[model samples]
Target: MATGLDANGAELFTLELARFNGQVVLRSVLRDANGLAERSAWFAIDPAQTAIEFAWQAAGTDAANGYLRLAVGSAFQVSGDRREPARLSGLRVLQQQGVAWVSLIGTGN
Candidate 1:
């Protein structure tokens, strides 16, 4: 699967992966549907990353955030188990290698 942007990043479609194993340096940023990055995220994978669904919850209280896209590296791990999308002012668009990468951004609650 690939990415498809309708307009101004409003309607978006992409291959959502909870984990990555493509061995690529994934550069991520989050915003609303207005193309603005207020924060940044970084993830590194090797071809064995564990992918999961954003709506997935852990068996314990350490469940991932439902409003953010989580990433787990070989030695470091980033989880999006913050909360459901609660705010919306704009959107973010992150890319590496011109158009080769994977990303999952939260919209809003």
Candidate 2:
């Protein structure tokens, strides 16, 4: 699991990658339900210097779990994924908390 924080150092959300029924699932826990920009099941979070770009979408979308570019001290909900590029966000190894999976099998990048 990887935790993304805000400029104030508060826990904004967590990005987790897990294998379920032979498929990889990407989930997010926003600080509050209102933190999310839309009522979607998944998000493609691109971490940037000032904000985290989130692309909200339904579950089971293969392109949903690509790659994110977040660095830290990044605020959440600054931008919506509707206009951002579509890239599946990856879990940052260095920013992970809890049990880190050094080697994940079917997580297609």
Over the stretch 1-108, how does candidate 1's per-residue lDDT look in tens digits?
A: 233333443422222333456444443333334545433344454534554222222222443343434344433433344332332333343466677444454432
Error of 1 at 35 (Å): 3.2
RMSD of each: 9.6, 13.5
Instruction: Please write out the lDDT profile of model 2 over residues 66-103, one tens digit for every residue.
Output: 22332224423322223222233443433346655433
Model 2 bad stretches (over 4 Å)? 33-109
Model 1, which residues run further than 4 Å from truth?
1-23, 52-66, 73-109
Q: lDDT per prediction?
A: 0.37, 0.39
Q: Candidate 2: give its CA RMSD in angstroms.
A: 13.5
- The lDDT leader among the candidates is 2
What global local distance difference test value does model 1 have?
Answer: 0.37
